[model samples]
Target: MPQDRIKTIGRSRIQYGPLSDRVYLMQLAAGEAEAVITAMAELAQAEGYTKLFAKIPGKNAAVFEDAGFEIEAQIPDFYADGDKALFVSRFICKNRRRSCDAERIQKVLEAALKRAGAGIRHPLPSDWDLTFMTADRAEQMAALYSRVFDSYPFPIFDADYIRHSMDENFRYFGILQNATLIALASAERIESGVEMTDFATAPKHRRASLAAHLLAAMEADARQNGVKTAFTIARAVSYGINIMFARAGYTFGGTLVNNTNISGRVQSMNIWYKPLAPCPSNG
Candidate 1:
């Protein structure tokens, strides 16, 4: 098990969980943010981290901006109660930004959706099964993840991590083939929004549309739970998963440049999101 690297500076909770290279500002203290950010930077450098990122409230944005953090993406009224959130990042490694136009992401999502209208009406496999995972299934889930992924943002490969997360506002779903689990995904409640994350499938099960099926169930659960925004910070170079989000109706938000260290190296991630409730901008 990884050590608890969450630093409590004033009232803020800065975390360095399983994904070690990136320190997460899990809860930015509402007051004394400037001081907290300063402390965060110092600690991040001391830890030899490459990045410091946060999903922060819009009200405290200036503090992060003043600390040399850039806004990677934003969602209006993201917090189910009408608050906005910003995905901000500070690079302790090399100061870099990838070129990712909002319009370009829209174009890509549109093209992907055009190519696959079937995702809109996606249905589960006839013989396969979808069920919410329980704590007893943690070891089973971890073993399945090992077959598909080398690394993940969180510590899903560890049954203890899975069990702890499942207790902390995370809902997991799995697809069973002949009563054996072959695919898995999770929706983690963050503030008022939900991140459709931790998606994995065995190599033998690829191209079988299991992900889309599980995702459909995940989103429906989100809507029922009153989640307003759904998003994913997916691997940028992953054509199939990226397309899957677009096909499921998530629009492109922006790119997080070399932000995540996954599968043994630092990888750029694409932001894809969708609104479950109608937007005021649309009305």
Candidate 2:
């Protein structure tokens, strides 16, 4: 399946295509809510998309609610000014509103919640080298992502796309052994914080607690960079990722039902977030 295309409509960024079979209002600009809503609806109708997913400020929820959207999840203080980010959705296809894997999803959530605050930060293994990835390493990163995920919401398997994202606000990090990249993750800069995402570990390296170490390092780096918060939208049915976040002390915000197309299917996602200490002032 082709990757979704991200485009700008009325100052807001949207990702819509056959890959996810939905229109994702990824970012919304102030006061552009109505135009974005209308445009996304029109696009969804013309393309026969089954879902319209949006992440908007809580204050603007009323407008979207009036347009048939309902809040699926939310992260408080998601913005720098203390505004919450609401994950709202309107399912054009009735079946899309319900997850077929609801039982498994809930089980994962319960397991993760039981392990909350149990994550202990471990040092990077003696033989592993943890390094911040540059654009030159985009190919290696893309190769790792390709091996791990059959499909992703973003075009992470493309080397050029990885490079482009690095040039933007994304900072990729990798754990390597003997010069071979074994695990990878990235932190995307958002206003006053970063999104800790794109975590992938080589199959052979699983159960070694690599993700926990990476999460710790990412949090430290984000704090040093003046980031005030860190968050992730992980695959809801995945035990490892959800538990990892819970162990790392991230609070469970809620779930976005069938909101993301990942690993070759439309899957729901769980929101997790943590507040980070700000960088020290130079003065």
Candidate 3:
């Protein structure tokens, strides 16, 4: 992979950085706790990684915690049903630690929530349009992403990487002005829960509530498509997006400590969620 290191080990999909000290664990199924933990720690030491991060069902938190992983955050009822999700991290490389501005973020989040704008704004004029994107528009999407974010959590700003994710169950939506793509978001559905993320807006149009309009459109479409929930892991330090979610009526789920590498640094993230099923029609 031209991006991060991806490996499949015993029902787990692990993504790690060759030049970084962090690891992301996905699809972490049950069983083989000792083997996975031991092997991962040894590999982290050998490959110079400091921490391994995993977001899993809350029920599994205890098992991983017993294996040296510590709970960083929890989102209540995050699963499609009523199960919760917990973010955990294990330090394998000695003397290497990562800490976010948790105290500051708490204050910022609280203050931002007080000023949240609406989630769904009125539709734009005819000159502005919104459409669900495909792999062919990856270059445009990547360009906008690179412009908006100096560093992204994943290798999404790469066109080929976008196509790769498309093949692995990812979808994109774009906002266009005068037929030019301006803002974008994605909904990566896992079962009945959709991760409403990867949001970016062009610099000139940042104040126009394009994200809010786009989110409303996405949710309306998702409702028709059988989506049961929408959720996000928003950057904790960013007031704009955080407030946007709050305005949209998403419940605040807690903060993930130093969770993702974004905008050139490892930053903490906040979880926001809303149930999407069995609802009224969109305006």
Candidate 4:
């Protein structure tokens, strides 16, 4: 299957394609909100997409709202300039606005919150080691993501993309057993915060609490690097990931309706966030 395409429009970055049947305004550059808004609408119309999702600074949300966009989630003080981050959406196909799995999504959220902080700091298995990934491991990382998800919003199945991202504010973490990568995650730097995403574990490696372990390490790394916050847009129906984030002290923001395409289908996502204290610089 063909993956989504990412491109820049008037200094703004976007991802749009049939894989997700939506256009995502991934980054809205300064003074480019109007251009992005127009472009996203045209692209969605041209491609027959069902949704137009955007992550914009709170100050510019009124522009999008004036264009028929609605707020789905918000992150307070997400940017270095003290502006909140808003996840806004405009629905092209009205039917795509509702989720049939609302009950399950809620159940998962409740369960995760109910088990918050239970064994989240479990020790890594004796034979496994957690380490930061180098470029040489890009192929292995891509392969791991391919095995875990049939389709994803990002081109994680491509080694070159992984390498390029690693060079641009992306820190990947992996767990290895006997020197072979088995589980993986990444932290993407965005201004003063980092988005903890791209989590995947081999089928055989499930139920071992590896995601929580990776989150803890990612948080430590972020603090040491002066990052102030961490957040994730996790699949709402996924009990494991939601539980893991809640267990690690992340607050539940709000859910995005039919926002992402992952594992071969469109799914709503839940936002989770946590504040991190910046550690004294060792250097």
Candidate 5:
């Protein structure tokens, strides 16, 4: 049986899952460290969870390790601001054995990474107008996204998605030409840094550097907001977008293969990172 728990710790909500003889934890914060750890151990014991697995920030990793969790994987700069993310797992009782599919997962991830390498471009454009997308501009932005990614996995032109993006983050930008949306980028802020989500340019406006302009705008917004770096997971098939990012000075950081299933195939994704300023610190 699988059960979930939502515990309020300070201003953050920590969500955890207990399944079979295993527990999975997520949405942890620094302030609630002690409580969360205690709750996890208690839950593991009560629910007969012999093992626990979680992804946590590097800063709070010591707490988990001290609690007997072993660092199973280290994803560098997995979160914003270049904070490394640690995957930790612990065995509760001596007699219990936990089975894992780590190797299969890793192989899928590696395939995705290989795909990312074939289609990316770093160091994007420098000069472009970037602005927040309002209700008035939502339709135009959607149209442009549709034109660029006609077969995107998610409905890019949805009004609800646009509103959610605006409400959740200040990292959304639109490239306008004569007051018409030609390109767009959306991002969300995380504890370690900013994650670039959707970036697209109208097909009719490609080659004219509309996507480049949009990225430049995103960079400006990142700087203004004290963001240290910007990162993204790009589809391995999008050659044009990758090329523009490369031209603008972004670097290939890492990749997550088959992390996302898109267009009926398990698409590979490339991770890219751009430092906002020289010698920037994520913390």
Candidate 6:
């Protein structure tokens, strides 16, 4: 198995790994502009990666392009606010020529994503026994996710993502009632603050405020870890989640137009951010 690399450039956070011939980049923060450029240049030099790819907010498209990345795809109305997203990539070495027309490919992919209506929600319950997942816990979490998101691709609830969470110093919590897994949430540090990911609750547990309880617990954990802000990318269609985050004092940061690819379709995502008492300096 190959190990993924994570680096903090200034306040920005980046994660990258080799997926075959291409280097797949995930979780690039907006604040780490110079750091990402320097780090990418170094990675290109050392790893001989042919291409580097990332998903970024539409507003930040020009920054990546200026850094040598080209738009390979764009998804419209893919976020909760119906904003657009650009999928970008660049050849590490100038000598490596790309074969496909990036603009054209992006148009095709965006059309397909528009047809798929997968959406997300957030700021869920914080109650129950929430902790890192064990093998048994993974199975239970998968089953709950499958039931909650029957139309979307279920996450590969293996120990690897869980271990990755641990490596990043993230707290992965699962809610259990009567020893049965009912909900889950994850919090990881980012350049801006802390981001909550992979929040889900089983259908049977919905409307019972399980998600709200879980979110409260997650927030408490984040505060303990020196995280002063909380954020999430939620589905625009998920009214319940949006409301929950609002009730918790999280303000609307912005939306990533088409940031999520689900069930072979594109959907819009909303960016919700909350200041956890004292905000962390982006210094």
Best by TM-score: 2
* Superposed model 5: Cα runs more than 4 Å off: 1-56, 59-82, 86-130, 150-155, 278-283
Each prediction's TM-score versus the true structure: 0.86, 0.97, 0.88, 0.96, 0.57, 0.56
lDDT, candidates in the order shown:
0.78, 0.92, 0.77, 0.92, 0.61, 0.58
What would the per-residue lDDT of candidate 1 be over residues 214-254, giving only the tens digit for each residue?
88888888888878889888877676788888777787777
CA RMSD, predictions in order: 4.5, 1.3, 3.0, 1.4, 8.2, 9.9
In model 2, state the lDDT of residue 158: 96
Residue-level error in angstroms, candidate 5, position 191: 2.3
lDDT score, candidate 2: 0.92
Q: What is the lDDT of residue 230 in candidate 4?
A: 97
Candidate 2 residues lying further than 4 Å off, grouped into runs, are 121-123, 279-283
Give, for candidate 3, the lowest lDDT window spanning 10 residues.
91-100
Question: Which pairs of residues clash in candidate 1, taking residues 3 or more apart in a chain or in different chains?
Answer: none
Q: Candidate 4 on 108-177: residue-level lDDT in tens?
A: 9999999776757567888899999999999999999999998899899999999999999999999999
Candidate 1 deviation (Cα RMSD): 4.5
lDDT of 6 at 264: 35
lDDT for model 1 comes to 0.78
TM-score of 2: 0.97
- Candidate 3 yields a Cα-based lDDT of 0.77
Better of 3 and 4 by lDDT: 4
List candidate 4 stretches off by more than 4 Å: 118-121, 280-283
